[model samples]
Target: MQIKADSVEEYLANVPEERKEAFAKLRKTIVENLPSGFQECLSYGMVGYVIPKSIYPDGYHCDPSLPLPFMSIASQKNFVALYHSGIYADPDLLKWWQQEYPKHVKTKLDMGKSCVRFKNVKHIPYELIAELCEKMTPEDFINIYETNLQKK
Candidate 1:
């Protein structure tokens, strides 16, 4: 389900009650573990962590008016989704996460290029998510992002 909210609080307020606590804890894990320089905000209708314009003035390439999005947490119809751009942009990081997921979560990894879907909120691996959040800084993301952009 897509939540159209103006702010993170509004978004959380709108999340289905079934997923609220898990979603909130996931958001907290990210917020507390993410290295300094990323800002929290509502982005693309989800609770997002981004590199503010003050940190990366150019902003996101697709929409320069917005900040550079690094991660997002959303409550979907059947799952809670955690989207991390670092894992998508960096092969080594992606490999690291894939290898690490099973150690923390017994269920098969349910993931897309960047989105990790947790159909069972109780099984969401908060600790692994926290480590993932710490894996990249804003500057590191910008470098990987730009390098990938240049290849396009």
Candidate 2:
């Protein structure tokens, strides 16, 4: 699942051929919905969308050297995982997702605070996922991150 690759392309190349198309489609949706100023790259052995250092000089609070992570997509052993930091930090967003996701997809919503696990590609709700991705701009995420850090 967590294939250690140097780049996004390499990560994708290593994914099983049967899973590649689904990953590509999900990646495309993520890219299309991502707000400007976020960079796509490999991070934590997954394809990560991040707020580049230029925008947030401090980078990720957990690791200042790394870019601020906004979202990520990775292939797991049994499921594909989609991570959205906004949903994890924003109660309203999480509530909205919990209420709305099941309406769009018949399957059970396999999700954690930040990660959504998809067992089948067809069961993924791209529209909902895109909507969630578009909920926060890089600036907005930085604001939230900083605020949360201050609280800690």
Candidate 3:
């Protein structure tokens, strides 16, 4: 479920009415917690946090024209999703998130390689998300991203 919009505000405006408040809070949590160097923008039709071209001229490995994507939040058809590249790239981070999720939310974790799906907005764990956001800085991401890229 991609909302066609050019900016974060426009993207948020198109989110399903039922998810508006929770989505806003989720966005706010990410913006407030993510490190200072990451810039917020609309990327791949979602609200995204990225290391801008000025910081990482090489851009994304998959698509060098775009900035280095760190994370994204979207309201999908069935649920709201948070996509964190750091979690996908780091096994330790993934394990930590998996272990800590149950401590914050009782529901069984619904997750993908890099996406965390929140089916019930009320159960979204903002505090846990904040901790996840703080775990990596832009420099940390660039190093991890490049290190993994070289391995491939």
Candidate 4:
């Protein structure tokens, strides 16, 4: 569920009161763990961590006008979502998460290739999310994105 917001602050303000705390904590964790050179902004109606055009002139392959997305967080109608592009691009990361998340989260792990959905705030694995954020620096993500693009 994307909420139209001009900035990260605006995005947070727009989030429902019920989800505020969780979102704030998750946002904090992401910001703290994010590698240098990644900027936080509103992208696709969510809080997005991106590689700015100043560092990666190519921007996103799908949309040159937009910065290259590293990760994103959003409060959905039913759950809060964490999207990590690095985990989606790397099979090893995905596999590791699949194996490790269950040990940490009491609830069933509801996840896709990159998006981890949490129906309850308590179910969110903050440490794992931080690890994912730390694992991919802007330069690494850009290189991976380019390498994948070439294969297509």
On residues 1-152, what C-alpha lDDT tens digit does candidate 2 reach at each position? 57879999999998877789999999999999988999999989999999999988988877899999989999989888999999988788889999999899999989988999998988888898889888899988888888888899
Global lDDT scores for all candidate models: 0.93, 0.90, 0.96, 0.88
Worst 10 residues of 1 by lDDT: 18-27
Q: What is candidate 4's TM-score against the reference?
A: 0.95
TM-score list, all predictions: 0.98, 0.97, 0.98, 0.95
All candidates in order of lDDT, best leading: 3, 1, 2, 4
lDDT tens digits, residues 1-152, model 1?
79889988899899998888888898889989999999999999889999999999999999999999999988888888999999999999999999999999999999999999999999999999988888898999999999999999
Deviation in Å, model 3, residue 62 alpha carbon: 1.4
lDDT of 4 by residue, 1-152 (tens): 66778888888998999889889999999999988999988888888888999999988989999899889999888999999998899888788888989888888889888899999987888898888778878888888889889999
Considering TM-score, where higher is better, how would the candidates rank from best to worst?
Answer: 3, 1, 2, 4
Report the number of the highest-TM-score candidate: 3
Error of 3 at 13 (Å): 0.7
Q: Cα RMSD to native, each candidate? A: 0.7, 0.9, 0.6, 1.1
**Winner of 1 and 2 under TM-score:** 1
Clashes of each: 0, 0, 0, 0
What RMSD value applies to candidate 4?
A: 1.1
Which consecutive 10 residues in model 4 have the weakest lDDT in total? Answer: 1-10
Q: Please give the lDDT score for candidate 1.
A: 0.93
